[model samples]
Target: MAGFHLPLYRTNLIRSSSSPAPSAYTKPTVVTQNLSYWNSIYSDIESHLKKVIPIRDPVSIFEPMHHLTFAPPRTTAPALCVAACEAVGGNREDAIVAASAIHLMHATIYTHDHLLLTDRVGREPESEIPHRFGTNIELLIADGIMPFGFELLAGSAGDNSEKILKVIVEITGAIGSQEMVAGEDGGVGRPAGLLHGCGAACGAIIGGGNVEEIDRLKRFGLYVGKIQGLLSEKSKNEGCEMELLETWRALALKELEYFDSRKVEQISSIVGV
Candidate 1:
């Protein structure tokens, strides 16, 4: 496999007693490199997202969406989507669009979550206009952003209608009221697990994986998501959180046993195992 390497140039100066020293160039040094497939995919997805969601009119709503979507520097969702696709032997390009959609979906959900929190905690003293606008307007913006995510999926689908449709269904269900929103009501369930698992499974489908492979990857995603949720819960005891994270990480690794070691390592990197 190809690796990432950086070239270092060196210049040597030779002193002459009778005249000015002449400069001599030495051979460039090359360091052994290991390329990260996930990083490459992330760069592609970032570029694609920027093009897909450019700034538009009605700056009040779109600006907030853009800020929430890009400002934080998204890494997990898009990386997982692309990694899952590659893990299942699918081209990374096949899942880039879906990855972008996944990111937008998360942004929309986060916007809604922020609005809900702001409603209870009251807006910050120096909050943006969208935050000051309160829940109703934010809701409208969320609603508007949601459809654009689907539209991106539709546009990226090209002639592969069935695969894209499956991805859409999986993602929509994961982010719907039953899963992610369930946490809003103070539920104990790990909604992040469902969301990540669903995203991986959808990416697997997009990558043309067989049913068995997709199922395995979905389980892997579930465990990874569970870890994420546990880590995010500040109220949870640190000892218990570490225990659960280890358990889930083990389970996630088990699911990827059939894949190549390199691929497994890449997935492990994403899961932070």
Candidate 2:
């Protein structure tokens, strides 16, 4: 749901033959240095996810949660979160907890989206959204993951309580009051845009970004989110115009124009410029 992902895009952060592969937005490249950067973030998030959703007695329910959390295609969201933190001068530690929470939130959203996908074709040989889990089990997985995301946030609350509180509001607001629990919208609309923006904003908040800086990154993320939405539509053969994607990309980069390009060098590279 989050916008043009810096971690995801920047990790392409793997450059491209042209600007970048549209698929770049979906997942990171393996055969690449930033690959290590992204993997480190993934490893940290995975650890937090394990601690928060430890495999318990039934194993049935918990296993799927872990599977979904670590499953591919993986996410660009956590990397973007940490990048936003770094872009604002916060280290990875400052944002790891929130990154983990955001990771789980997206996992639930992804599961919910697959649930809503008709025929559940593509990406799976069996033509099932999730070949392993039943629809009923998926419902459980969808419902289970998001709260644990919040648990990561709430559990990490401390001296940063005020900042964490704002981050809470940002994330929940993006997920939508009902969408978080019901998975109603599937985050295919403006909520998706907000999710991307929320991700950057949360990182900025945790990283101690000033009001102006946070707003700048938030808008940058929103533009990226819009591009992400259109690209998803285009991939499904929905006929999205390429011009719009370029426009959003331009606007996102423009937001960083006045700032020290050095800070956002990786993020700016998202477009492969």
Candidate 3:
């Protein structure tokens, strides 16, 4: 199997299937190397995002789009995408578009969540949660990026054209499904679960996994996401017992047992992050 790697050169939103993307990889032999591996993935994602959501005309619109996408602490959705792909013995490039799309959409969802919070908070400052730009402008930026996600995702799939099409369907349905619509009313608890499940499934599919492999990884993501949800006070207030975090964590690791040691090791690290 190919070792985990990150593509070095910049790639456009769209790439021809005939041309293979270039990457460099080394065996994961030390903790520092592991950190470097993850760091490289984050850097590559940010670099691609710069190209994807560039500073363009209409600064009012593009500026916040850039801020929303790039400014805050990065989320794990994009990392999960790339990690899942590599865990399944696929190139990181196979998952870049879907990864970026997941991050953009998730960021917008956070924007929506923040807007709802501000409505109730009534101009008062909140302690946590990265809030920036005016609520109105944030909403407009969210709307602007919503459709851009589709454009960025559609037809931008690499060699995994058919698989990426399937990923698009998975993502589109996941984002609009009842869970997501209801998730809007609450915190990221439910929505993050959906994102994790969808992110893992899309990565596996694009990585050329078979039905069973994809299903295993999807289940893996769901359990990990539940752990994330349970970590938040909002989700705990919603009746998730803190004890269940261990249970979910155990269940998540159990799912990894279905795969070989290397895949399980890498995936477990991703979930840990």
- Top candidate, metric TM-score: 2
Clashing pairs in 1: none
Please state the error at residue 169 of candidate 2 in Å. 0.5
Candidate 1 local Cα displacement, residue 251, angstroms: 0.5
Best by lDDT: 2
Candidate 1, residue 150: CA error in Å?
0.8
Pick by lDDT: 2 or 3, better one = 2
Question: How many backbone clashes does every candidate have?
Answer: 0, 8, 0
Per-residue lDDT of model 3, residues 1-273, tens digit only: 123322211111112212334323322112111434555677777788898888898887888999887654455556767878888888897688888888887777767666745345433354355566777888888887877887788768656568868887877766774654443445433355777778888888888888887888888877766666554433224443545755776787787787887775766764442
Give all TM-scores, in the order shown.
Answer: 0.74, 0.76, 0.75
TM-score of 2: 0.76
Give lDDT tens digits, candidate 2, residues 144-212.
788888877888888888999998998888787554333364433325567778878888899999998
Evaluate all candidate structures by whole-model CA lDDT and list the values in order. Answer: 0.66, 0.69, 0.66
The RMSD (Cα, Å) of candidate 1 is 12.2
**Candidate 3 ranges with C-alpha deviation above 4 Å:** 1-34, 116-132, 181-190, 234-242
| Deviation from native of the Cα of residue 212 in model 3, angstroms | 0.8
State residue 147's C-alpha deviation in candidate 1, in Å: 1.2
